[model samples]
Target: MKADLKQIQSPIKSEMAEFELRFKDLMKSRVKLLDHIMNYIVRRKGKQMRPMFVFLSAGVCGDINDSTYRGAALIELLHTATLVHDDVVDDANYRRGFFSVNALWKNKIAVLVGDFLLSRGLLLSIDNDDFHLLKIVSNAVKEMAEGELLQIAKARKLDITEEVYYKIIRQKTASLMASCCSVGASSTASSPEIIEKMREFGEKVGMAFQIKDDLFDYGEEEIGKPVGIDIKEKKMTLPLIFALQKADWLEKRKIIHLIRNKSENKKAVNEVISFVKQSGGLEYAKEVMNRFYDEAMTILQDFPDSEYKESLSSLVTYSIQRKK
Candidate 1:
C-alpha cells in the first residue's frame, strides 16, 4: 500500500504539532521586516519531513525531550537558510509553489535573511550547550556547500563519472538527512554507535530519494518538476550518465553536444530523453534506487519493532514513492 505522509507521521503527531509552535518561536525576530518575512516563511513551509525524521529517530533510539525539539529546530533553521540562499543563487522565483524569499523581498534582503537564519540556528544550539547536534548539522552544511560547488565544477566540463555522481548526491542530499537522524538520536543521549547506525540508515534512504528524483526527469509521471528540466539546465543525472557510458564514441559525442549546445531547444531535449530511454537508462536507475531502499530497510531491521520504527519505514517508502 502507498504510504501517505499523514499516516506515516501518526506516531509523532503530537510532537510534530508541538514542533510547529516551537519552530515559530525560534524564528521570531525583533525587527519588524524580519518578523514579517519570517511569518511568510512559516506559513509556506513544506511537509516538515526533516523534523519528522528527527522526532521519529529520537523516538526509536530513546525518549523525545526538549533537546529533541531543539535539535529539530536547528535542522529546520539551517536547512531553511540554505533554501533561502539557494533561491538567490538559482535566481529562482518560486519554492514549493509560492514566491521565494528573494522573489518577495529582493536578493539583498533574502541574503541577509539567510544569514539571520543561520545565526539563529547557531545561537540556539550554543545557548543550550547542544554542541553535539551543532556539530552534526554543521558538518552537513559544509558537505552540502561542497557538493553544490563540486556539481557546478563538474557540470562545466560535463565529465562527471558514475563515481562522481554518487559523491555529489551523497554529499548534497544524503548528508542533511544523515545529520537529521544523527541529531535525533544524539538528542536522546543515545550511544555514539546507535547514532552512527541511524545516520547510515538515513544516508541510504537519501540516496534512494535522490535517485527517484533523478528518474522524474524522464517523465515518469506528469507531476513533480517538469520533465527535462534537469537536462535543460545541463545537469547530468544517473540515467543520463548511465546512457552516455553505454553509448559508442560517435553517439556519446552527439548527445554531449546536444546537452551542451542545444539543451534549451525542445526537440533536442526530447531527443536526449529518447536516447536515454532507448539505452534502458530508466530501468537501470530504478534498479539502483531499489538497491538503496533495500539497504536502508536492512539497517532499520537492526532495531526492534516499534511504532516509531514502523513509521520511519513508511516515511522511507513515502519518500521514494511520492508523486512530487
Candidate 2:
C-alpha cells in the first residue's frame, strides 16, 4: 500500500517537468485580475494524476510528443475549471486543503474563472487542429455535467440503484480518466484500435477508483474529504447503496428515513456508517473495485513489458490504495 509517489514519477520526470512549464504557460492571462487568480491556481495545484495517466498511457502505446503535453494540460484545465465551479455550486470554502477560488474571489468571479479556463482548454485544442483529442475531452465534459445533474436529481430521493450508481460514477468520475487515456493514445497517433482499448482500460480503473473513495466514507481514515460527507450531501454512493440492498424491509426504511432527515446529525451519520459496515457494504464494494482493477490489469498485461507499463500498473494499484 506504500508507493513512493516520487518513484512513480521517475519514469516520466523530465516530461513532467516540461509539462509543468506548459501547464503554467497555458494558464497565463494578460488581464490583471485573471492573472492573479491563475497564479493562485498554479500555487495550489493537486498531484497532477490526470497528466500522469496521459503520459503513462502514451509511453505504453507510443512515443510522448508535444500533443501529449497538450492533452495533459487539457485534462488539468477542464478539471480545475470544474473544481472552481463545483465550489460555487456546493458553497464550499476550501479545495485540496487550500482556499477555493470561490472562497477568495466570491461566486461570480469564481464562476467566470471556471468559464475562462474551460474556454482556454477548448481553444488550445481547436487552434492546434487536435480535433481527435478535442472530441474525446469534449465528450467527457458532457458526460461529467450530465453525471452531476443526475446525482443532484437523485439526491433528494436517495434512490440510487446499483445500475444508477454505476452510471453516475462512470460519467462523473470515469469519463475524464477515460479521456486522459484516449487523449494519450491519440497524441502519439495511435491506431483507433489501441486508443479505444486504452479508453476502456482507463474507464474501468476510474470506476474502481471512485468505489475506493466511497469506501473511505465508512472508515476512520482522515482524507481531505470529511468522513460521511457523501451521506451528508445526500449522495447515494456504492457502499451505502450496497448496504441498503442487504437490509431487511424494516431496516431499509429506518436507514432511508435517517438519510433523508438526519443526515446533518453527526450521530445519525455515524449510525448509518455503523449500519453500512455491519451489513457488509464495505466488503462488497471492495470486491467490485478489485474486479475492475483486475480487468484493467489484464488489458495492460497484454501490452509489452517496460518501465512505462510497470509504472502504469503501479498507478492502477495506487488508485485503490491511496489514503486520500
Candidate 3:
C-alpha cells in the first residue's frame, strides 16, 4: 500500500531544522551585503527533500548518527549552492515565488555566495572525515553542473530525444537523490547490496519528483506553476517529448518551428498545452510517473516495516500528487 505524506514527518523534520540552522550559522560570517542576500535565499526556503531523504533513509536503516545530521546539512547546502548558480544561468528573477538572489544581489554576488555555500559544505564534510560521503556528494555536484550545461548546450534543438531528456533529469535531479540515500546507508557502513537498493529507490523517486514538477507547468492555475516557462526557455520536458512522438508530421513541424524560434509565449504555451493534450502527452507522462513511483515502493518493500520506511514510501506517492 502507498504511504501517506502526513505520516512521514518525524525523521525528516528534525534533520531539516538542523540543516537550516547550520546554513544560517555558516553564512553569518559574510559581509553585510553578502549576508543579506544569503539570508534572502534562506528565507525563500524549500521542501528540503534532499536532506529529508538523508535523514529518513538513515533512520529506516537504523538510528540517526552525527554523520546523518551533518550529511543532511551538507546536501541542503549543496542544493542551495546549485539554485544560486541556476538563477544566474536561467536569468530567473523569481523562484519559490520570490525574487532570486541573482535578481536582488546581482550575478557576481550570487555566484560568490553559492561558492561559499559549497565551500562550507565541503568543510563540514571534512569534519566527519568521511571521504566516502564526500565522494558521493561531490559526484552529485559535478553531475548537476554537467546536466545544466548539457541542457543549455542543447537548448531549442528540435532533435532532442526522450533518451536525452531522461539523461538530463537523471543528472540534474536523480543523482543527488541517489547520493543522499547512498550516504544514509554508508553512515552505517551498510552492505553494498543494501546501499545499491537505497540508491535505486532514491533515483526513481527523484525522477518521479522532476517529472511531476514539470507537469505543473501545464496544470490549471489552482494546481501548478504558471504555464509556459519551459516553452519560453526552450527546455523540452517529458510532455513535449511525448507529444513529439505522437504528433503528426505537420504538427511536429509546427512545434519544431516554434521551438526553433523560441516563440512559445503565454498564448503559444496554451496552444502547446492543448496540442499536448490532444496528442496524449500528459497521459503518457502520468503513466510513466506512476510506474516509477510503483517501482520505488517496490524497492522499499525489501526493508522491514518501520515508520521511516513508511514515510519514504509516502514521499514517493506524494511526489505524484503534489499540486506545487
The 0-to-1 C-alpha lDDT of every candidate, in the order given, reads: 0.95, 0.91, 0.81
The digit string of per-residue lDDT tens for model 3 on 1-324 reads 654544567647666667678767866764788777777777778776677788788877877887877777788888888988888987999988888888888999889988988998899889779777888899989998888778887784656688998899999899988899988887777788887889898899889888888887777437577777777778888988999888889989988777667455666667787888888888888898888888988889989898788787777676677778
Over 1-324, each residue of candidate 1 has an lDDT whose tens digit, in order, gives: 887899999999999999999999988899999999999999999999999999999999999999999999999999999999999999999999999999999999999999999999999999999999999999999999999999999989899999999999999999999999999999999998999999999999999999999998999877998899899988989999999999999999999999999999999999999999999999999999999999999999999899999999999999988888
Q: Taking the tens digit of each residue's C-alpha lDDT, what string does model 2 give over 175-202?
A: 9989999999899999999999999999
Worst 10-residue stretch by lDDT in candidate 2?
216-225
Best by TM-score: 1
What is candidate 2's CA lDDT for residue 259? Answer: 91
| Model 2: CA > 4 A from native | 222-224
Query: Which structure is stronger by TM-score: 1 or 3?
Result: 1
Q: Local error of candidate 2 at 225, Å?
A: 1.9
lDDT accuracy of residue 255 in candidate 1: 98
TM-score of candidate 1 relative to the true fold: 0.99
Question: Which rank order by TM-score, best down to worst?
Answer: 1, 2, 3
Report the CA-based lDDT of candidate 3 relative to the real structure.
0.81
